[model samples]
Target: MTDIDPSVYANYYWVSSQFYKFRQEFSDFYKSALLYLAYTSVESLSDSFKLDLAFDLSLSACWEITSTTLESCSHPIIKSLLGTKVEWLYYILQAFNNGDLVRYQELCVYNSALRAQPALVENEKKLLEKINILCLMEIIFRTIPLSIIAERTKLSIEDVEHLLMKSLSVHLIEGIIDQVEGTVHVSWVQPRVLGIPQIKSLRDRLDSWLGKVHTALLSIEAETPDLVAT
Candidate 1:
């Protein structure tokens, strides 16, 4: 395996992707191709090939796979992308990884290179849906009002309900929607490989929780001096 040309793997991946595309098995194609790209020695490929592979993988329908790529910045393939024509592609993927709908929209509108991708142009609606789902994941509240979801996702209340239903159906999120209350009570969110931003978000949440606990303890001590041992 060490002696074989890296292009051999790249060529095989490309051919397999085309086969899956022909069958309209987009999810399978993305999963397999991304795994191949992640595991292979992408640095051995030409710079042109690396750029093309990065672009192709960035447009994957599987947000989990594309988003995970952001965590691999140290990988040769991802490192090779820096300071190149497609460097914006890294930020584009970061937007998706961070669930920044506004940034994603800005990139789409302002980046002519992104707009030129026929795959992206054709699947704009699907991409919107994906970004909305990502936005939902970023919400910290387990139980949230539809209005809040609408505000966060930039969707109408009706659309928010539909999006929640779609997310539920796909098992992206485990939750129940209360139509009368216009709220969703989420029990779980699908876990994925975390990138730097997500780790930072987790750290922030932990700090906030600790602060709240300290405040509560102080309040308890002040109000219930008789029950406090200290």
Candidate 2:
């Protein structure tokens, strides 16, 4: 067996520590797969290899059994391991694996929040702004008013409204009122929130957008001069 990479441990130390502490909080299958993967030394492999290993590990653990609700142990394990990217991957795999798509998608949404890290530079900030708009695209189907997104994301109401407008402009989110407030009609919860496929799709879109933003920022930094004349 190869010695684990100290750098992998350094890069993901906090996440790995959290995994260990909360490992038991997860169901059985996820616990087992995560434990196995987490124990593997990422030090020896290239980053690409590590990512491929994660994807392959998920595939190997997933099985064909159409009737199994996403309540299965493997779903969370996949989410924890892959973040939002895995959610879409879960849906793709579901067509082949016979796992529950809806439940797994919902897990992806919660996992999506973890994907929101602070941007290190200006272009990254732009990319996050765009990604945030994309993530909120489904709000069009949500019964709640545009105001709630701000609360959910802890942004000011204006920021939320701005995001909503951007999402609407891009056809990411649309809005409808099934009930009249003065007429006192009851509104049903939109089932969009829990869908595993949607969450996974959203996560992938966000991840890709952020990657571009990060790359753009890096290029800018590379071209900037160290000092400027007054």
Return the top candidate by lDDT.
1
lDDT of 1 by residue, 208-230 (tens): 99999999999987889666654
lDDT score, residue 133, model 1? 81
**Model 1 lDDT on a 0 to 1 scale:** 0.74
Clashing pairs in 2: 5-43, 88-200, 105-196, 140-174
Q: lDDT of each prediction vs. the true structure?
A: 0.74, 0.44
TM-score of each: 0.78, 0.28
Q: List the residue pairs that clash in candidate 1.
A: none
Task: Using TM-score, give the best candidate's number.
Answer: 1
Clashes of each: 0, 4
